[model samples]
Target: MNVDPAVPLACEPANQNAGTALQDPEQGALSADEYALFASVARVRRVYAGETLFHRGDLGTTMYVIAKGAIELDFGEDLIAKSLGPCEFFGELGLLIGDHARSADARAIDDGELLELRHEEFQRLVEIDPTLVSYFLRRAIMRVVFNEQSLIRRLRRRNQDLQSALDSLRATTQQLSRTEALVRRDELTGLYNRRGLLQHLRERHRNGATSGLGLLLIDCDQFKRINDEHGHLIGDRVLQGVANILRSVAGTNDIACRLGGDEFCLLVKAETREEVMRYAEFVIHTSHGLLQMPQLPPLICPMSIGACLVCAEGEWNDWYARADTALYRAKRQGGNRVEWQDNAPIPA
Candidate 1:
């Protein structure tokens, strides 16, 4: 990045209209000889608004001191650059580097006047007054170094603050993820809980209630006998095994949940009654397989499943109750069969 030079002293309005006789540097703090040299060499020039004083890559053999108004700097298409008011000077970097061209384009933003100094005249002044040259050069170097150090410190602090913010964001995201999983899952079987399944049903209802909204309520046939024969621990394992079977057979958009005890439910968005039946058959056929236990004989766990298709006008409880009644009828007719509430005969 190129840094502009500090504004020149001759640019000050107080110094602008000073009579030629008093234009001598000695008129202020300068010695008589120094004032004579300053006055003799400096030339005043006027620039109008919208005028281009210089452009990037132009030779910078001379510098200007703004006497009045402002100069604007343009980097490119954008006016992101700044303006220099009266008493501000630019273009000294070219002189210091002995470069023939400028690094940026300079334009007059308003009608302005400048005191121009040729490279030769500036060099002559420096030669005659080493003390003045040394003082100005030291001040310039100190200002540049101090500004650089301050910028570095600010950047470092900002980077540290940004890193800390990112860490906090990451931690918060992890915690939310774990919480969401817990909210949607059944603690015992790791299947979806009743609340989660109901939430999914509501979402489906909002999406135009497409066909094949099949709901099934499954009840273990003679669950009380199983609990009496084996322990609740074994019964719990059986329930979990049932949940796993339902999860495997269900589609990605389907939901399987353990309502409570040995009762479970499934929700699927099927396009037709046949599609619903196909899934029901899979569940029935898969549940026939017995679960093995160390202390108990192979348990042939069977489920009586009843299914119903959801209609757009019906309430959520209406579909559930109809399916649940079908489930009871299936159990009454000797378990382990798929029944539909539409009076379609249970699959043989």
Candidate 2:
């Protein structure tokens, strides 16, 4: 949030060598009328060293013209101070403005003198000498415009920097979201892991919008027999086949997960017992095809599938128990078949 100090407008003071060119009575370039107006309408004041002519934030409508010796304008906030000697002018901006506050402090560096004109007296001089009023008015307005334009440029640069910071923050947030998704995914199967599945179910329950939710619990029949005969490497291949089968049968909205060791489950939407049975049959049939694949030669046993019609309002553990009970029954009925807890499959 640090910003470089701004360069002031060209109309502001610059280094200048003071001289006594206007010391003589007739040397100043004022007409007889202007001289009379200047003397009558202006007041003269003198200050000793370190004397304050005006303080910032003080209200006034007078502008001072430096007459003799040396004085300086100091802006404490900007840490700027500029010296003015004889015949140089400052604070003309106040004369053209109404009820103006000094933007900086004015103090004497040495014994100095200044000529000040109140706004009302200046207005009367303008009436008497309209051309002279026009001369100073144009210069005063140009100084104000230049200062304001410089401020605008600084503000625009600051706004651009803020926009760039916001864009970087948005990019960082997107990267974090992608990283979180990778953490939830199962590396081998590309399905949700058990932890991921539980998190998903909790979110769904908290939302209270889960309707027609269904659960399918599956087990590979005679899986231990295959591992005993062909070794564990071949057993891992059979588990991978089960993952593929679940992927094939899953609907777009369904969440399929491997719950470790020959057990898999699919969560889906199915309002009726018939719809749940159809999904269970699809999964069982797909898993049976894995036996034909060359890598699953030892995995010749069929899969057992059990399904439950989920009640969205009930606890998920109770619903899962129903599916487990159905899976136990299907396995007891001797492997490759579908069963349900609330409703049984029609005899074929």
Candidate 3:
């Protein structure tokens, strides 16, 4: 199992300076007496070129001694490889440490003959020639030390790679969090957008508490006239003023959203139809007061709100449709008013 320590033992091109670090290269081959002793009890195994004897991490129970041709031991990525020629032995760890896992892949570099030695065969050989067995055992211990040093080097390299991977993951996570925040909000009003409303609806539905909720669909009456008479800037100011009013009245469990353009909606927690009607009236009154403030541009844009209590058996489309119907009715009666729908539509 032990080879001269000075030589770089690895699987590389044949042109590379590699082999046992013995002072005399001939010493790498077994002596006639050593070969005779092993050949007596060893089983001959023939392997063709490119044949795989075992893979890294496989449980190894037998050792192989090369008799002719060559074998290559490949220690995967960032480690040295070893190529064994005639008379050199490998896989002694399987015999030394019972049930040992192979640290490298063993494959045939050429059509070769190897002497396979199992634990029992090795034990019987030890009893017949104790002196020779002790000599090999001493070498085996040195081989284990050499392999331990190699493992320490491999672990150090792995630790560096792990830290780099962790840093990249943290950066990616931060970017995703920022993107999610931007996606769920309106840039102008800083209110939850349509996408955010859908997300909130999904969460509420998941909790199975769809009842006792109210939806108010508010629209800016004659919004196009406001933009044309004054300026688009003044029109924007009116929408912002309305958004501020909705934000002030919303409870902790409520969501206020800009459903695009001059349309906004509020989803609030309410116990009865009266409570929902009161909330809509509060929004309409507050919105009028805020827009008429002396500091703001002098423009009149009345808000018409359609209010309804959400039904447990219906979805958002059903809830919005009923609110929308009530909204049109309010606009028809008067520009600045709130209309409540006592009953929500039944799903078909």
* Cα RMSD, each candidate: 27.3, 28.3, 24.5
Clashing pairs in 3: 10-81, 10-82, 11-81, 11-82
lDDT of candidates 1 onward, in order:
0.65, 0.66, 0.75
Rank by lDDT, highest first: 3, 2, 1
The segments of candidate 1 whose C-alpha lies over 4 angstroms from its true place after superposition are 1-157, 291-300, 343-348
**Per-residue lDDT for 81-189 in model 2, tens only?**
7677654556655665545566579999998666677876677766665544443444344444444344346556445533443354445445545554555667676
Tell me, by TM-score, which candidate is best: 3
Worst 10 residues of 1 by lDDT: 1-10
| Model 2 lDDT-worst window of ten | 1-10
Candidate 2: the clashing residue pairs are none
Task: Flag regions of model 2 displaced more than 4 Å.
Answer: 1-171, 292-301, 343-348
Query: What are the per-model numbers of colliding residue pairs?
Result: 7, 0, 4
lDDT of 1 by residue, 187-293 (tens): 88899887677766767668865455788888888777878888787788778878888889888878889888889988887766787778888888877645323
Better of 2 and 3 by lDDT: 3
